[model samples]
Target: MLNLTSPILSDGLTTRSISCPNYSLRGFVNPSSKPRPLTAKPHQEIKTPHLSAVAANATEPLLFSSRAHERDQKDRRDQKDKLVVIMGATGSGKSRLSVDLANIFSGEIVNSDKLQFYNGLEITTNQMTVQERQGVPHHLLGEVEPEDGELTAAEFRSAAARAISGIVSRGNLPILAGGSNSFVHALLAERWDPETYPFNGRGSICSDLRYDCCFIWIDVAPPLLFEYHSRRVDKMLERGMFEELAELYDPKNDPGESWTRIGLWKSIGVPEFDRYFRKYPPQKTREAANRDDWDAARKSAYDRAVREVKENTFLLAMKQIEKIQKLRSAGWDIRRVDAAAWFRSALSSPDGDGGSGGRRCKEIWEREILEPCVERVRDEVFCLGEKQMTATYY
Candidate 1:
């Protein structure tokens, strides 16, 4: 019978013993010692190359084991196939940030804003200008025709999925940026439950995510955000927003019925200006001679419409914020970056302050919002070399 026993030596090393019945050969093998030939000639010496020497002398490329290679491929796929979602209220700079991140990450943006999806009403929907896009490719922005029909959440999910797949197949990051929470939920949630899809408040929506996602929430204080929205409305007006609406307006169509049409017609400024447009038809307003009471009534109606746009915009921002809060409460790992300071600075700065105020606001935005978000995205996507990025609640 052959017997084997492993015993701890005095040096804390494990040694194995082999024994036989007829001819007992007892030896202690030190596992940590260099391996030796089982049998050798009387006057021969065996030399083994040192590990470093072997590596230095090797001419062929080093190869990973089959298992190691497979693991490496999986890691590469995980690193490449990631989604960055930017969610926030209107006028929270979501579009600008998306463009900036796409530039840094070599990504393509997929727009999720419901209103921005439709064509026309560029100014009314606050669509980004070609110059403002900074040469980054944006998907689904101004792609839909309002006269066609309303775009459902499911349809958006399908289109967005295809866009993301194409972006990933081209070895580019897919960045979904917008304030359309319903579309966002529809796309990212693992399973769809129509009744409680967007804001279940029960934390069921994000229980299982469909993709590896990093969500960024650009947050601002309510008062400052509302003030910023008002100022933005004024800027849009200056940029011929009313003219864009006028081009779409037709005296033959009923203002109330036209406003009720799905898609672009439902945009904030469009419906809000219905009464004003009806009262003062574009052509008639241009042809009518100046009369005190008539002009006064037209001006009053115009002012009221403008005020309604601002008020409705404020209310929309509130609802967007509420939905975002509900999402956060429901276990979405949303990274919040407060932008109230930047808004306050921009709002307080005197108009036309030699461009110094604009520069200062940009600096603040970079420091407070952009840099942190970049770091977070970097950690989420590229930091896989060191550790995996996992969602953290709250």
Candidate 2:
């Protein structure tokens, strides 16, 4: 049988095919450019230039073998494809540690935080900085518009999967980072199944549903979560939350496919209040009778926002804790770190009490929270790689 691997094709004619008599018969030869006599026979021996030399050139085999070796090297490099999904309740420190670990592991940050995907409101959404991104590369952060309403967990998972693939293809580790617990769980497991319920997207999506991926839950406490959220909103306000909210109000600058479709335009819904305020601007002085009415309306809107924040955070915390328990029972590597340690690690340097304060917090984080998570991810990746190798060998 002919060796199909060889580049040369052999015919019944043993002579070089290029010098065949059929070539002259077919008018292929340049008679003026070559010697007058050209010899060819249909059944004669044909010796292609490389045919007689391939056996002597060991480099040819070496080049062929190099392809397999190249694949092996690529496999080794991509063995780090196993993802470390950092999940927590709202106000938990998922984003902080995710970014830090990404830096450490030559990884890319996939934002699982829903709010942080918007175009503006960096402070309000707590989006990462260019310096923090550090050419380390982050995906999905600041990629959406504020008006885009109620992007479901399914949408987040799809975006995350694409982001993860892009990261892995570029030979970087993918760190799924966010405080949205459902987003993290769903992406890791690839289970988009939401609970069957009455209203649209209202029912809880069960994390126990089967999926081809993995889930890691970062356990956090309630009190710390409350405090973190309260402080976060306060900080956002101090950092010009109103200005960002105002910018989103332009009737002409319509942000289609945004949270606005679901009627969630502004962060605090303050723009809605602003609309009210504009319709009935506060009169110059208390002499105006309707001034009291306007002030009361304004305060009511603000108070409503505060109430909403508090209520939403509580419900999210409860749901997230339940999800964590489910993932743990489902044979996932769920690591519950010290809540205080995780909370402290989220403090940015300037926000830290002092240099020493930040350093101490960093030490605790590396020792208690982050190190263990990294170890778990590495172990899982190695185990999966071993399984794949065993299957290939068989």
Candidate 3:
């Protein structure tokens, strides 16, 4: 039997010794008994006798090796390219966590959020700023032009596949991150029959994945998530979301610029503000004079639009959560990390307070969400214990 004398090293090397009863070296002869004098001259090449029998019996020890050999065989049999997928609702910090994991794993992110595919409207779609990305390369983010029209799921799968291949070629992990579960489903599903199983139909999107996936699902309580979404909409407005939309609100540029049309205009905030923009044109024409009585009406319309944006955002979060649940039910081994406590603490803390509340919330997030996710990803990449692969919420 082969016995591991010490713990397996972190580098996967083991210090093992074989212990067997009546196991002798078959042809290991004692050179001392032969009394062969070393008569070789200095710096001369010495020829030693080859122990062919001992060399032939070298495989005997391995035959009695321990479970480590079995484990190595299993790893070889199941070896597949690894992929990390980060999924969550709108305000659940999926983008932030993806960035963190990519940094940890020497990874590059391939965005799956369909809304974030278009150029401009960064605030409306909540695309990560270059500064916020912290220099980690991101793919398919704001690469599509507004006039280029909406990208289909199949098209996204093709583009994302190329990006993933490129990232893998550069010896980096590919992290598929965003709230667009449809794009993710498109790219990861092994066999998708669009005709028979329509995207929105009750078809089972099986998890016969193309790559070995480590799915990290960030979950927040619905009440806390809704409250967080409402606050985030207000934050977006403060960050000049309205002004950004105003710049893109040129109905004269294209007759098909309506929110109902397929394209960047289909974003939640863009459509909701359509009426407000019509009532109060961003650039008032000289022919149009503003009356004092219209001021109250315009303000009311603007406030109503903001309310609708918040409501629509909440609904979108709900739909994203439902899709994630469906993915879990469809045989995907998704690891869920609960950030509801983090959200509650963050919501209670005043924004820009520069106090311990903000720091404490960050601590909670790292402990409850980020650290667990990092551990899970580490285990997957290293082919560690199966106990770490359990589908339990952290």
Candidate 4:
């Protein structure tokens, strides 16, 4: 069997390897041999062995042997072209799952989230914090263009395709994770013949690269999902999302550009939150209302803006679901995993009087939702990389 704990290390992290069905019934191989505990090794290069994809189906294969694996690695080309598509609506925990999956499979994250592709809107876009990233390498986050140009779907696919190739060439998985339906659809879509149909689409599936890609669709129960989104927006506000929007506001822009200072003003929460920044002017309005003995009026306006954001975001998520169905219709492989299960699992954990309970709850969430979802992907898709598969969770 291949050794994962050898000299190869990932920026002070271990890239745990998995075995086929024989390694465990679930296709996981825990590297029992411990290498020297990793210390700070900044600027050190990571060396990982290339893993070839074995034939996948109902059929079983021989147990892993070093000689056999080495020979297969030399002869086969499938392992060099694996891709993980982490997608779903906003508030469904796509970012969290991508981070966890990348850690397990020694993968890098390629951001396809359209808003995340821009700069200076990190909090507004719900960009994953560095601490939340868990030390995995992330590419294409905040890769904006000069002069605030409008980024087309094709442009993003080109960038993401390059990033995917580099990750695979390094013997690591390439995880395309985000909720940008347009970008995801464009990247995985069937190659279009522009001469035959110039207007339909110019999107390329990049089939020339021979990637065996599968979509891990993270979902949340609708009722619970709305609550999740509301709480998430509240958290964003607490973290100064309002201030971020205020900094980017410009009343002189055409009413058509009511979103923000730049072209990406159409991002999910931006348009909805525009009211709070423009007409409502929360803090200023509050002070003025205090003089008139109507401070609650300012609070009411802010509350209305928050409600609109929550409702509009829900509508946006529903539209995304429709778009995803179109991809499913076009025969893209997708696996659905529910995030409400994780949230419920976390909430159901024992509670305490202090913030300790909240921290412990997050631990429960990782153990329950995040880790298992990645393991399932390892077993059902990545380990058996040749299958065109689909599974649904509600």
Tens digits of per-residue lDDT, candidate 4, 96-202, equal 77886776666789888887776666888888888989898988776574235656665655566666656755656678988877677555544533233222345
Candidate 4 ranges with C-alpha deviation above 4 Å: 1-80, 145-147, 193-210, 257-262, 280-294, 346-368, 380-394
Better of 1 and 4 by lDDT: 1
lDDT values of the candidates?
A: 0.71, 0.53, 0.71, 0.60
Error of 1 at 284 (Å): 1.8
Q: Tell me the tens digit of each residue's lDDT in model 2 across 46-82.
A: 5576854766776555354788878876654433235
In candidate 3, which residue ranges exceed 4 Å CA deviation? 1-55, 58-78, 196-199, 253-260, 285-294, 352-357, 384-394
Per-model C-alpha RMSD: 19.3, 18.9, 15.4, 11.6
Better candidate number, 1 or 2, judged by TM-score: 1
RMSD from true fold, candidate 4: 11.6
> lDDT score of model 2?
0.53
lDDT, model 1, position 93: 86
Q: Report the C-alpha lDDT of model 3 over 1-394, residue by residue, as the tens digit.
A: 1111111122111111121111111122122323221122222356765777556768654353668788777654454556889999987888889888776656789898988888889999999999889898998888887776677776776677777766765667788999988778877877765444423666668678777788999998888888887888888888989889888887654435453466687788887886777877777622343334456777688789999998998899999988888888878999899997788787887862112465788788879888788778756653434442233222
- TM-score of every candidate relative to the true structure: 0.74, 0.59, 0.74, 0.68
